[model samples]
Target: MEEVIENPDRIEIEVTDVTNVIKPFKFTKDTSKSSLTILNQSIENIDIHEIWNNTTLHICADGGANRLYEYGGDKRSEFIPDFIVGDLDSITDEVKDYYKKQGTKIIPQLSQYASDFMKSMSLILLYFNGVEIVDVDEYDGLSKLMNQLNDKHLVNINSYILNGLGGRFDQSIHSINQIHILNQQYPTLKNVFINEQDIVFMIPKGRNLIGYNSISDFYKGNKFPVIGLLPFSPCIISSWGLKWDVRNWKSSMNGKVSSSNGIVSTNGVIIECDEDLVVNIER
Candidate 1:
């Protein structure tokens, strides 16, 4: 992960087109629920309040509900989650009741096979796909619920998951693993993990435009937003709009993995790859 190649040729990718499509949703300060955001239990003093306000459907994963309740404090009433999901083990009775009274749908999935994070993901797919479970209280409702989504039409939604990283090391790895698996199961859904310091997402195979309208639009004051092009599996990658640009760069877990790279593009960054790659940018 530490080796570096100097003066590699930049690959040609359409960054401007990709930026045009995702710019409004990613950069806008407008207060409208245009996407989905999930909160995990490791919530801290995150400054991305605008993301919370702009998310239409917010779901908390069990103890994630607890963290959100505690973080909101005086403004607790203002940040009620749309759905509080997972096994009822981590959520406190008081916090549960508070959100329940506020009309939040509390879903309890008792299956130990999948983690609370995965359970919440299933709930998101079910809700977005318009598949309502009549036996919503079933211990493993999400298990069967996901099956029903096969016949239903699902709209592609961008998911911003918070507190998924910066926890236990194994959990962070698992979260990244789930990101890859989820993309395979549900190809349309784009999942992004948001930690306190970085924003991470999977770059799909072929060309991907990591676009932005302006530098300030994504990172207000940072002249060079630090980034990394990580390879969980073997892949051939090439890039543009970066300080250390690479062409046909072979990357893998045991080989050269691009880390501590910086974005140099005024507008956006473009990456072309033969397989899916994980990308992280400092926020």
Candidate 2:
């Protein structure tokens, strides 16, 4: 599989709306902000406070609550999570009591089948389906509510997850696996992993017009943000507005993996692909 540099003859296509997926990066206030989830990892160099202020819903995956508590320090009271969920493994009693007093819903998900991250996502899914967050007493309730709805499409709520990446190799791979599985099962549930240097998410299979609020600012600062169109499997792709744009290029893990690609357009980049791609926008 080789890159097709020449695409003088190509038909125009419709652009998918992915602006909402990248709204968190814009630093603009919105009536409907994305939800935030904290994982069990050190949030070094990440501004957790700014993200907390922008999110509508918040969840801490077990020990993640402890991380949040320690990170908040004296201002811990101001940074309460909406929900703390897990098998009661890592979350300390004092930390739990603190949040419990602040009216944080403590959910005990016992089944080890899904990780705390997945369980947290289950809560998000339940909430998006119009199910009251309080009614979900435990992990089983999550499945019960899910069965009641039996709907493929849940509310399209954008989610920003912190500390999900750059951890243990297996765990990081698990997080990425969850993102792929979540997108396949619930296409509307847009989950983005926000790390120190990148925002990772799945770009759907179709023509997509990817953009940022202040792309020209990056250019002005002489920092054209790097990007990638990583394929989970073999697929054909074409792109515009990138420094190394490709046309009808065949892509896959075995060959033609696109990475370290730069964004050159001041407006946005239009990527057309036959399969869903895992894209990482370098900060």
Candidate 3:
């Protein structure tokens, strides 16, 4: 059999489109004391509503639905997830009933083999492929559906995952592992993990040109945004469009890991890598 390389075109990722999710805060000389207190204690400000609005498809992982509900508060009615998927472990009955009444697809997979995050990912695959009639009650339903498809049948979609990182220590590591595996299995699938502080995704090997309308599109208010070109494992990288650009730079955990590097590109950064590198940009 002859070898086949799918999607040989240069991958272009735009982290700027979703930057509006983080609202910029501005204070005036006439600002009231109570308004300042509200601004300081606004936990709701970090919510994923803006990201949710920006994405074409939104799937919540198990307890993630509950988090969305609480975050939305009185405006919970305004935002409804397209699909709620998991082992049905953390989602409460009240939360489940709430979305169920609103016609949200609540899928419960009782399999211990796959995490809630993976289950949601499978649903995303099925959604984009237009795979109708998925057995929501079946254990490992999404996994089984995915197993039935070949590489040519698997299409790429820009997926934004909320609440996948910055949780419990072990789970957070698992989230990163899942992101890496997903990239390998589906090269075209653009998976982005929206962490509380930064947005993380993989930069595929080759010369990647990331373009945006302006530098402020990805990093608003800040003149320069902090970014990292992290090799989850050992890898050599060369880059451009940064304050401290390096040519053919070697990187690893024990060696040099580019962290807190400033983005000097008025628009975007370009990187060519020997291996897939984890790219994290401060939001």
* Local accuracy of candidate 3 as per-residue lDDT tens digits, 200-248: 7777676775555566565564456778888877877766667677777
Q: What is the C-alpha RMSD of each candidate to the true structure, in Å?
A: 3.7, 4.0, 10.7
TM-score of each: 0.89, 0.88, 0.81
Ranking by TM-score: 1, 2, 3
Deviation in Å, model 1, residue 81 alpha carbon: 0.7
Q: How much does candidate 2 score in TM-score?
A: 0.88
Worst 10 residues of 1 by lDDT: 16-25
User: What is the C-alpha lDDT profile of model 1 across 55-143, one tens digit per residue?
Assistant: 67788888888888888889888888888888878899999999999999888888888888888888778777888856685588888
Selected candidate, larger TM-score, 1 vs 3: 1
Error of 2 at 175 (Å): 1.1
lDDT on C-alpha atoms for all candidate structures = 0.75, 0.77, 0.64
RMSD of 2: 4.0
Worst 10 residues of 3 by lDDT: 32-41
Shift of residue 70 alpha carbon in model 3, Å: 0.5
Which pairs clash inside model 1?
Answer: none
lDDT of candidate 2 over 1-283, digit per residue (tens): 4454422222233346543233435433434636889999988578777678877899999999998998888988899898898887999999999999999989988778889999888888877678765556464666566665575556677788996988789998899889999888887778888888888888878877775555653234465778888898899998877777788899999997889877766656788888888888877
Best prediction by lDDT: 2
